[model samples]
Target: MSIKILTILTLLVPTLSAFSQEKMVSVNGVNYHVLTTSLEQRKPSQPVLVFENGMGMGLGNWNTITDSLANDAPVFLYDRQGVEKSEMVYQQPTPQKIAANLKLLLKELKIEPPYILVGHSMGGIYVRAFAGYYPNDIAGLVFVDPADFTETKADWNQIFRTIGVSEKQIDEMLIKRLYTPLKVDSSRYAAWSEGQVLTDLRKTDFAELSSLPIPQVPILFFVGGKLEVPMERRSKDYDHERFFEVKNSSNMLRWRRFIHASSKGGALIYLSNSGHFVHRDDAAIVIGNIRMMLKAMEK
Candidate 1:
């Protein structure tokens, strides 16, 4: 290529990229980084897909998953408050406040109603709360190894101990690895550690949700077959099922029961070849399932 043409192309690329940078929104004094894919392509009658990341995970992890889904419809994802580029939030909020922020985000973004909410890990709880709070607005729900309120304090410790992670190790890892790179001050880390973040995330009022009339929306549960548990970290009775199981039972009987009781359509798929991060572990499964959902909605 000619020198003039090459120079022009290089200059145009960064300019185009700058136009595609992620957006930042402040709702109720909390700043957050958000990415909305293809709002222009979204149909007025169709529901938009909103993705909620697992605990400590940022929107960066959803690149492939969101892109694949965005091919058919709009997709949304955002970094949680105080994490990543969200302006380093320090004050912790309750579950209700988090859910309220999500509702507000959707309103301010002007995302069309009837959302297909997809959540992973603790995010599942948040989405569930969102669905419960605004049942009419949510068209479908997808849970990927979601955390539950059923897990007692003892259950949390036992499961962690069984997998060889002490509370101290968790605290140290968060400080040395997660916070250190962020250059977060010691006081903030101290405050975040006080609740053992995961422990705090598990404190949900699912019982009331379970007791309420089930929402008439489609639900999908993708059970990850692969686990990240190191052989040395697990006990002699180690099994991947136990590690990824949302409840105490290896068969996920609780989830199965919920499905059986629900009036809405639901499916249980075991991603035998994939692990917790099903988007990357088996994009085909996640994509195919989403396509199936899209097809069903067409009817």
Candidate 2:
């Protein structure tokens, strides 16, 4: 195991990389890449936890949080068909279709009802629709710095521009920083179809969540109180306007407030030390809050 030999092997087999334990689950001849683990350690009555990933994110982005909690429940993760390991078929999938597909996936796998739905960013949008469409099946909800229409591309882009990023640079950044880590082919992100699916779904999902009656289930919305923008990048591109005027950006503070009103007990937590990826930024807080919500449900 000499250094030279190791270096030679690495160069010769650039594609040689370790992969996680996973499998494909098919529903109606459509195959989906599913990564399931941790049920063995689950308590008999514990509700299954299903993760709905954010736009341009895959199961890998959740490793930091899921790895620790996987043993605590039957945790399920999958690609939204065509985004990553899952084969792509749907084009600009609607919110209802997304919700239906997830329900089907769960049904075929026998994951059953009373699920704890955890969603981040735009993933929260789909989770909202799922709860609305199948309120009886959902037990609880955990939203990590969830996104909604209150904050628009204009708001986000202005922030980027303030940080001195050109439109082209922003596109590249989204592909590299947001999508690439998920194993998404960069071209798909750049394409019209790939971007439109989430964009249209966001509008549809947001409307669905807004129009629905308040949920009776336990719901917890976590907001990253203060956004932490990259200082080096911000400084280099500083125009002195503002780096992240995102204090009022999250749905917790605005449009999605009804979620907190879902129940007198529904809660909203602002994590001052965290950012968009709240679970990754402060898993302890997220886990602690979830445990607290579960405990509350008993009463």
Candidate 3:
């Protein structure tokens, strides 16, 4: 696949509303586009299911997962400050800032918590930060192929070595996949760069949350077992599939560490048929596991 394809797939802006209603809500002098399902199915005591999208992704990314979940509970999806209909921010947005903004947005909308926060990829970092900052507001957490801050160049190189890829080749592949620029509009580039900055700063960014006591909420971590990368993101220079398989092996240890830190009922589920976008690749599994968690919580 070409860079054009990669650009389209990676930074998909929301042009369509996938939920029952789409509206803009102001929080801290900025407008954020939000999509919500009907509230009729939700009870006063029930926890709201809130979803956070991956880097450069819009609320629409959760369309399939939320559609199935709408009947079970109220689902909330929103674009961050720089994506979709949301206003752009002048300052760098860290997970902590995003979490704080989300809290204000929820409060302004009168969506009272106990919330089940489901985050995919980079969004996982934000959800984790939210739970840390406001432990009382969250009931459970779901991380779908989350971004691992502890991942290092040495860890990646070790995984690539399993596929017989030399250090130089591994470095090259990493640069190409990570640092290469996509041919897109300046605005999209700006939005993507902001997210990239936060990812790069992940190790030191959530320091306050890291210092605080870990939230003991029920955590569900989904680690994708399949090696699934878009053709555009893959190179002909190496065995990308084999490399991804090895990388997934390395990620399992990290995912396990995350799940183990949560409450007794937390689970680390491995889906062999899924990829990084586990919710998209295997929506049934994502929906089923989340439904089970919700049911258990309800009991």
Candidate 4:
């Protein structure tokens, strides 16, 4: 009887140990709640792709893409501080700060190198900063309708001023907006709503953001054409033409310039019927493009 019990216990130890591994961690005093899925027990040869959600979004937003990609390689998704299940730390959330947190998180979690960052909207800014700060850590980058630093800043300032919003108010609004759920989550929604007021007071400038260099990695920009009109309307008349030029070109010129400067290959794909939430709205398209990119990279 003792021998039989020892055999069962030994068999169950590995299973229990695997289940005990945590999927979340705190980096630089910020809580990052991560969701990960690995199709195989062994580490994959392909680089792990980390998905970063846009402002006001959480790791849960990438469920569809992560599910599809997990079949090929390990995939990870995480919510930034003050969002979703993550603990909110009181500080200015800039691209640089976020990048630092990511690095710390990876180190603490023991995530090996050769990472591919897939960032959407403002999340792209964070990834760009990350790549610049730790160039050796990245394998590639994919931007889904990322915000143009100069353009986004100018437009945001103007809009805020026009709406009679102070810098503090704008930050607060951002925090509130992020907390409010487009779908549903009563607890998170309330927390985000209250956190906005604190964030508004801590907003930073574009100059700080512009200091980061474009990464020298294979990149793919997936633009959503459906949101073009709204994005265009947000621009000032003086900046509208230039914004339209870049937008209409699917940001080809900017990518070209960046690629040339970095001496790396990059491409852009314009999706005609999607919005800011490209992955959510058209998961199949996003997944297909990534697969294609991966195949090309293999060659």
Which predicted model would earn the best lDDT?
A: 3
Off by over 4 Å in 3: 1-19, 161-185, 202-212, 230-238
Query: Best to worst by TM-score, what's the order?
Result: 3, 1, 2, 4
lDDT of 4 by residue, 1-299 (tens): 11100011111112211211225465544456766555234264567787778876877778678766766556667788778767776555656667877777666556777788999877776777788888887878888887654334345444555545577766765565444445433455533442342233224434554566665678888877674456546634334434444454635556556655555677777777887778888899889888876766576
Question: What's model 2's overall lDDT?
Answer: 0.66
Better of 1 and 3 by TM-score: 3
Candidate 2 lowest-lDDT run of ten: 1-10
Using TM-score, give the best candidate's number.
Answer: 3
TM-score of every model?
A: 0.74, 0.71, 0.80, 0.68
Model 1 vs. true fold: TM:
0.74
**Residue by residue across 1-299, what tens digits does model 3's lDDT show?**
11110111122223232236566777666778877775545687798999988887888888778888876788888898878878787665676788888988787767899999999988887887788889889888998988764466567668778878787888886676557765544567536655665545543534555665556778888988876568898867678888777777787786677667766558888888887899988899889999998898877
In candidate 4, the residue pairs with backbone N, CA or C atoms under 3 Å apart (3 or more residues apart, or in different chains) clash, namely 171-200, 172-196, 172-200, 175-196, 176-196, 179-192
Residue-by-residue lDDT tens digits, candidate 2, 1-299: 11110011111211122223376766655667777665444565678778988876777778777765654566788787666766667455555777888988888666787788999977787787787788888888877777653444454555676556789976765455334434444366523343564554343434555575555777788887665655554545334325445434434456356554656456778787787888888888888777776666556
Determine which window of 10 residues in candidate 4 has minimal summed lDDT. 1-10
lDDT of 4 at 101: 77
Which regions of candidate 4 fall more than 4 Å away from where they truly are? 1-22, 39-45, 150-205, 228-252
Cα deviation at 199, candidate 3, in Å, is 3.9
By lDDT, is 2 or 3 better? 3
For every candidate, C-alpha RMSD to the true structure in Å: 9.1, 10.5, 7.9, 9.4
